[model samples]
Target: MDESYFFKLKSVAKDRLSPNGEVAFFLGILLYSGALLGICFFAIYYAVDFKKTSELFKGLFIGSGVMIILLIILFCLCVLFEKMVFKIQKIIGVVTVLYTIFIAYFPFFYFFIYLA
Candidate 1:
């Protein structure tokens, strides 16, 4: 009876901590993917102009295209390497947090420095 009680308690704790590891992993990937898309959109938006800025336009187009390609590749990799992601869940969590911070900060910082 005591052993069964302990097992139930352990499972409850585990569920509380993670709930569902796969869901968490995919949610993290989704967030990063959205951020990458946002970056690509901003890059393209800022890069284009109706003036004679051929070089700048070309560079921005190429950079933004490359970023989109990279984002697709990352999505594919995450889908293919589910086991690996689960193994490195902690590292993924840390990186996701840092990336989120950068994504959130960039626009705010830009507006503060340039617009304000």
Candidate 2:
């Protein structure tokens, strides 16, 4: 009885995680990844300009806001593409999620490479 109960709970958890994972993966790829890349670029600009710290923070804030809007637009495009072009939402969604993960983490992976 106890083992069966635990198995049922585990299955339910997995079922719930699937949809949640889709959203989590989407936001992680779109928003957080874009913010990190934007911040890196902004830091380089700051280093070159020697501008006010406040300006840097302001730019970062504005850039993040812009990225959020762009993220929404891109997400809508993905949905529209799946609906109109592919007609296989899960396949396209999974592909986009995987690509986003690659885009988000590729820089970190590349950083570990050493020249021969």
Candidate 3:
């Protein structure tokens, strides 16, 4: 019913924040932001090039391909830090559950925000 009721990923992420874990989380945020920015970059770069449904499909596939690559890269980094992650697994568990709840809230969240 309210957008303010939306869950924050940061809150759970914060509870798990350790010096090293913070670094890894920071890295995730960094990579996440970078990947997002890179997507925006290419999306704009090809804005004029996608003139048809076929081109739009090509663009979508390319964007998805890039996202998959980024996810695998991030996954490897997470594995590299797996030893540290064990300590934070409980926190991550809560984060995951909260994230699932957050997904459900997102439509209401965005709809209200859009109205605002």
TM-score of each: 0.42, 0.41, 0.33
Clashing pairs in model 2? none
Off by over 4 Å in 2: 1-20, 48-74, 77-87, 100-104, 107-116
Error of 3 at 43 (Å): 16
Q: lDDT at 89 for candidate 2?
A: 47
lDDT of candidate model 1 versus the reference: 0.54
Model 1, C-alpha of 1: deviation from truth (Å) = 12
Using TM-score as the yardstick, the better of models 2 and 3 is 2
lDDT of 3: 0.49
Per-residue error at 89 for model 2, in Å? Answer: 3.2
Which candidate gets the maximum lDDT versus the true structure? 2
List, residue by residue over 11-89, the lDDT tens digit for candidate 2: 8877654444554566666666666656655654555332433554545446545655666665676555544423444
Evaluate model 2: give its TM-score: 0.41
TM for candidate 3 is 0.33
